[model samples]
Target: MSPPRRSELEMRKELVRLRMEMQRQQLDYHAEPLRHPLRQLGHLFAPGRAARGKGTPLAFGGVLLLTLFGKRLGRFGKLARFALEVYPLVSAGLRQYRESRPPKPPQAPPKPQA
Candidate 1:
């Protein structure tokens, strides 16, 4: 066949663009259900947020365990409760200890002077 005309080429380009836009809309439709769950998972595992400080991850894990295994935990449930109760005190003691320590002296610049 002879080379295609300009109008035909433009029509083909427009068709391809429309098809791509449709596919993108389809993708968003299918992914909508997973968006909220994936967002929650992302927040749970986000950098710096997951382990914001000492006992943070542990507290989260403990709560998760208690939520997921409350009945099965039996005697361990009491221990978990005790630990949860004392976590704040331990955290406070740690914070006080860190505050009481001497601050480190600033280091000189590593670059050589001109």
Candidate 2:
């Protein structure tokens, strides 16, 4: 006799269980440093890839640093947002200024050769 097929609910439950298992494994891997005293130093020197996404290391570091220091640097976020808001206006004014400037007089052509 053929085995009974799983119901949709059963499949979803199995998926949830698998996801929980994967998350536990990831947590265990990331927390491994706490198991050994020197491992934390190694972690600092050679950061683990377990928590990294597919993004470049620079992007990941930016995201990590931002999350870590964002509250302390909240003023900078406001400053950055203000700069972004003003950039187009400033650039447009600069462009207009450049465009409105009179062209420099052209140098007279070199005297024709004898």
Candidate 3:
């Protein structure tokens, strides 16, 4: 077979480029309907957008409560009793630690320039 001319190679390249572009456009068109839903799903699962320091602890406590109470009430009662018993000692230790820390020196006012 004869070697292909430069013009023929260029034409083939242009045809491939146009075909690829058309396929890309078609893919975009077909995916248009999914864009919004996919975006919403992304936002729903995005860690950065999740609520921070808000009801997170409360939600966790709620789940914990449900799990504790769902299976057995005695376990929850025991946990509560343990927490109550430890509260006073924990508070006393914290109070002693705070009292032992040295107080910060007060800042002096800036001197006025002549």
Candidate 4:
């Protein structure tokens, strides 16, 4: 006998329901212990918190997410910087290439709506 496997749709619905439950729990997120790393971040950024501006607890949760996932963010930062440096050259080359192309014939104007 083998364990039952769930369909992709069943797994997806379960994931969505779990996420919604988590979101509802997060509405009272900051009232949890400040000593915890995530709640400590909540203290750091929640508006009227003195350390940072008055931000809604739910909105400020992103800061806690960054705290929890900092290594991944640091890796992404390097990629972002390289992309930023390349963006200007890519855009300028694209602009010049487009400018060199022959213009298209103008389309007939649409008849006025009734």
lDDT of 4 by residue, 10-79 (tens): 9999999999999888855633443476656655555655322234465355545544553477867456
* Model 3: lowest-lDDT 10 consecutive positions: 49-58
- Please give the CA lDDT of all the candidate structures: 0.72, 0.61, 0.60, 0.62
Q: For model 1, state the Cα shift of residue 113 in Å.
A: 34
Maximum-TM-score candidate: 1
Tens digits of per-residue lDDT for model 2, 1-114 = 999999999999999999999999998874564466465434434534333322345544544454445446778955654654455466667778888999899999899888
Q: After best superposition, candidate 2 residue 106: deviation in angstroms? A: 59
TM-scores for all predictions: 0.39, 0.34, 0.30, 0.32
Model with the higher TM-score, candidate 2 or 3: 2
> Highest lDDT: which candidate?
1
Best-to-worst order by lDDT is: 1, 4, 2, 3
Task: State the lDDT of candidate 1 residue by residue for 1-114, as single tens digits.
Answer: 999667988999999999999999998975654565556345555766435444476787875676556557889987897887677677777888999999999998899779
The parts of candidate 2 lying over 4 Å away from their true place are: 40-114
Which pairs clash in model 4?
47-53, 47-54, 47-55
